[model samples]
Target: MTNWDDFRLVLALARTGAIRQAGAALGVNHATVSRRLADLTRRMGGAVFERISGRYQVTAVGAPVLEAAIRMEAACLEGERRLRAVSPDMAGPVTVSLPDAIARVVLLEELTAFAQANPDISLTLKCSYAYADLDRSDADIVIRGASAPDEHLVGRRLFPYALAHYCARDYFDQVALPDRRWLVRRTPAQWIERSPCPEAPVGYVIDDIDMLHEAAARGQGMIRGACYIAESDERLIRIPGSKVEPWEDLWVLTHPDLRDAPRIKAVMGLVTEALMRSRALIERGETDRCRG
Candidate 1:
């Protein structure tokens, strides 16, 4: 039988190069370190380490085993940390990943309220366009846009992800859109045709939603973006009757293991309620609905 404890002795000895230091680190006597190494070498039919200059020098064959031992220790430590993070108790860390645009415009104030409500649970909001791996626990909860949600996770589907054409409040008044350049994410043929200024030349092709929103707010040019974001910004106004692009279903997802956890459930409930309350703004740029 191969005991990982023996391999750990090998790693500790390799790192420190002295039996006394290895024994102190492992909370064992120096003789126990030497005995364990000798036993491991005998079982493997090779000298795991050689004593030279009163220090343990790893044999050529022992280096690979030591490396494996080090990797195993790191993996175990990470596993323990993850277990602590997902503890059954209500108090612990919870990370939610979502698109930057949504996080900034839709979830900013709602999330602040959630944090205030659950002071025991330390919450972290990670913003990214890329989907986080729920199985690996890249994020405890993730909000994403997807046509087909993963079957493994469980959560609520809020609404359809919608986008429409928009521009600064006084952009057209300052410059005729046909004469100015178009601000767009990508040059999609269909989108170009649907834009308010289809004949307008390209001004800036910004793929990042934040930058695109900024440019449009600054009266750079017309942009097509998420209705929730565009509607929330007072500086931006929707292009009248512009084609609305329905992208995908917006969902809040969590791993099955955490589906029933108290803190995760609490956060998910808040998000679902918030989205439900503002579904019109997110699904349609109904400026009147949100405006007081």
Candidate 2:
């Protein structure tokens, strides 16, 4: 009988083609990878790798073994997801990944409420710009802005997201836009060309939306951000004549294999309900200060 673990190591080595790289990817040492490969080759009675141009290449005999190993890995992962989905108890960790801005301003309270309601379930709120890999169990759920979702994953479209220009109450002045300093995310060019205050001078280039909002509130300069956050903030005032900057559709995504998990379902239900209830605020930027 062939050991699946040995085959997994072989597959990784074949995929990476370097002992150091494969070891790093598999969280093992280079010596371990070499030792394991030697043992695997001896057990199989054939060389699985061949040196080609000073790089390791899978041998003819190893190709089929690698393919089988990949299939086995997929099957095992799917089985785990399915088993987790069918768990009768609602006790486990559910990691939810989303943009830092949304997590801080919009989802924070709702997430807190959900956590309080479900003490048995542990929740990890990952705030990041990088997309989490649902297929590999990087996260159990994800809230993201996307125009199109992967066909393999199951997702629910939440609502449309939009951005607008805003400034602190004291920062607003009826002057040439070029004179005012701009608080931007990446660079001023992308926002300025499309913004109402196109020529606003660049001052601060911040990556984090929450920090940008704070700076704008302190009268640093005008800032651009999601309408839901800017409108709700009392310290910031929306710029007059600013147009809605529609980005992408917000979505709640999960792996197809774990879509039926009770914990995932409960979290998804609460999150969906919360977002649905705040649709007007999130989509239309409905706020008492819209006129201000």
Candidate 3:
């Protein structure tokens, strides 16, 4: 009888392409990966890996074992998702991931209300720019900016926004609109071209737009501010005569596997409803952030 442990070891080693790398990926020491390999070989009467210059490579004999292992992992993950969806009680951790900006303002507040409403369901969160792996259980839900969604999951529209140029009043008066001190997003900075002098065409490049907005508000530089932000901050004023544009779409996404589960359904419905409360304004970026 083959166990999941045996299958996992073989697959991890093969996928990593080296025992040491596999060990690192699995959070185990190289010796443990090596010992497991020897144990499995003795039990199955097969050499699963060939050592070449201290690196272990999967052998032809091991390929089938690795294939089986991958299938097993998929089955197990799907089974877990199913169990979560169908649990009789709507109580357990429902992890959500998002970018820090959304996490701080909308998702966090909505999640707080959800936790209050569904007292039994706990909300866990992660904030990052990197996408969470839904298939691997990194998060049960995600809210982020997207042009489109993955075919494997279901996504609901959260909002649309207009992006406009804004700067702190003091910075605008001192730095000039096209000066190097003007805060700009990475792509636009490169597109606009760099100039060394203050009078020369230049912009401050920042990867995080949310942070860029905050910096601009603090008089550090100028940047693209979400319309929701501009409407509220008197200190931050939009650049005169500069055309702004619609930003990317925002989405709340989850695996279809949990759609039927009561807890997941409850939370998903709540979030969708809360975001939609500002539907008209969010669609056009015509309302203030607080109102939305």
Per lDDT, the best of the predicted structures is 2
Mind giving the per-residue lDDT tens digits that candidate 1 earns over 1-292?
A: 2688977898789889998999998999999987887788888789889989987899987878888888887677557545754667778888999998887877889999878977888999989988898765678899988888889778988779788888888877898645776787886546776676668777868989888988999988888788888888888878766877777889998877677778888888888888778778777656673321
Task: Report the lDDT tens digits of candidate 2 across residue range 89-182.
Answer: 7888889998887787677898998899889999999899788988778889999888888878896998898888888876666434556888
Clashes of each: 0, 0, 1
Which residue pairs does candidate 2 place in steric collision?
A: none
Better of 1 and 2 by lDDT: 2
CA displacement after TM-score superposition, residue 272 of candidate 3 (Å)? 1.3
Overlapping backbone residue pairs in candidate 3 total 1
TM-scores for every predicted model: 0.69, 0.80, 0.79
Candidate 3 local Cα displacement, residue 183, angstroms: 3.8
Error of 1 at 240 (Å): 2.6
Query: Can you give the lDDT of residue 238 in candidate 3?
Result: 68
What C-alpha RMSD separates each model from the true structure?
A: 9.5, 3.6, 4.3
How does residue 241 of candidate 3 score in lDDT? 47
Instruction: State the displacement of the C-alpha of residue 166, model 2, in Å, after optimal TM-score superposition.
Output: 2.2
Distance from true location, Cα of 32 in model 1, Å:
29
